[model samples]
Target: MSVLLESRVNGANLYRRGKVRDVYEAGGDKLVIVASDRLSAFDVVLPTPIPDKGKVLTKLSSFWFGKTEKIVPNHVITTDLRRFPKAFRDVRSLNGRAVLVKHCERINIECVARGYISGSAWTEYKALGTVAGETLPAALLESEQLPEPIFTPATKAESGHDQNITRAQLAGLIGTDLARELQRLTLELYRFAHDYAASKGLILADTKFEFGFHDGKLVVIDEVLTPDSSRYWDAEVYRPGAAPASFDKQYVRDFLVQSGWNKEPPAPPLPPEVVRGTSERYRECYRRLVGKALS
Candidate 1:
């Protein structure tokens, strides 16, 4: 299977090469973001690439962007290559992986919402009975649905892992009003998605979002609700007291942990089965959520 581990457009200046995406400057106020097959785990980019993974992410993000535009404005301009600049249009590999978007001054915060207890939230809850330093109801089981979704903000680190902050810390950093507004938006979006996912027979356990100020208006930016950015599970199989089989990168993380590689730089390459399984899961997520196969 073919995979685009990186992308290059002769006429477009490279803007930023993130862990899984390549960004390009596409003339004034516009940018071309290309998702790549590169997968990262424990803050390290792995050597093997998941086939067509980039397209799944790009397609899923575009679908959600269209679906949620009424709920919130986003930075998407077009996913159609013909609408892109000549240079981007010249690359056939970028067809389903690249997006044209309006440039924005990014807000340096990671807005997260959790409808179910899992991951670091479950970790924190087990240890301190608190998540993001906010106390929760006692005896919450692992993967148990919360009474209501809660907003947990984190710093968008320039390097390494993002540090979770308390609501008060967020208010102090970005001002109380702005912080409150971010929380409101995060929970509202999560609730909408969680309900929608349930109708599709999946549980949106938790997700994170990035926002930026475009023309002085805050809009959702980067990927939204894709498997890469959210924890999704089979609703029928979901159970409390343990993590369910997720349709996300958690499988890769599980493999790495079981191998005892010691989470550090220079991660190991994924085996053929691991790569194939991950690719299938990502595609399955797209199929289930969009109610159609990704073209």
Candidate 2:
């Protein structure tokens, strides 16, 4: 299958090229977001591209934006290609992989919600009895659900890793009023998504969200609960004592860990089986959540 590692949209000014998505100025207070097939693990973009990955991310984010609109406003303008400007009318290559959204002044914070103890939280708890500086109950097993989901905010790093900050520290960075509002919205959205995923037979372990300001109002920006931004596990076989099989990019990360590759920019090429397996996992999550595969 063919994969698009980069997008070239005529008549639009290029904005930024992220680890997976390319942004462009689409004029009239709108921006175009194109999700590329490029995959990244451990803050490093891999050398290989997964087929249809971009379309899956775009569709899943749209599904979630529609699901959580009542909680807070978002930046999504429209995903319907037919309604796009005439300059992009012939760019059928972007049909399922691109979206036009309102341009907002993005808040430089990574709004993360954790419903379970795993990943960096588990690591931190093992040594410090804390997750993002919040004390957790002692003797909590790995992959165990927390007493309640918490809103853990992290700084938006430009080149290095994002450092986790406490609620107080978050308030210091973005002011108490905005901090309180974001914390409330983040937890509300997490609870709503967790309940929905449970009904679908999936466990949303954790997810990260980004927000921005539009005319003095907070609006959800960037990707929502897609696998790239979230951790998903099959509920049927989930256990608290060990890491469960997930629907996110953990499969690829596992392969890389076992390969003993240094988490650097010049990452190793993914094996054919690994690429194919990871592609299937992404598609499976989209099917389970959206009720259909990416067309």
Q: Which digits, one per residue and each the tens of the lDDT, describe model 2 over residues 1-295?
A: 4589998878877899999999988888888899999998899999999988898899999999999999988999998878777766678778889898999999999999999999998999999999989999999999999999988899999777999999999999889999999999999999999999999999999999999988888899999999989999999999999999888778789999999998987999999998999889989999998887667
Clashes of each: 0, 0
Pick out the ten consecutive residues of candidate 2 with the lowest summed lDDT.
Answer: 83-92
| Model 1: per-residue Cα lDDT over 130-226, one tens digit each | 9999999999999999998999999999779999999999999989988988898888888888899999999999999998899889899999999
Give candidate 2 regions above 4 Å deviation.
Answer: none
lDDT (CA) for every model shown? 0.93, 0.91
In candidate 1 the C-alpha lDDT for residue 145 amounts to 95
Winner by lDDT: 1
TM-score of 2: 0.98
How high a TM-score does candidate 1 get? 0.98
Task: State the displacement of the C-alpha of residue 159, model 2, in Å, after optimal TM-score superposition.
Answer: 1.8
Highest TM-score scorer: 1
TM-score of each: 0.98, 0.98
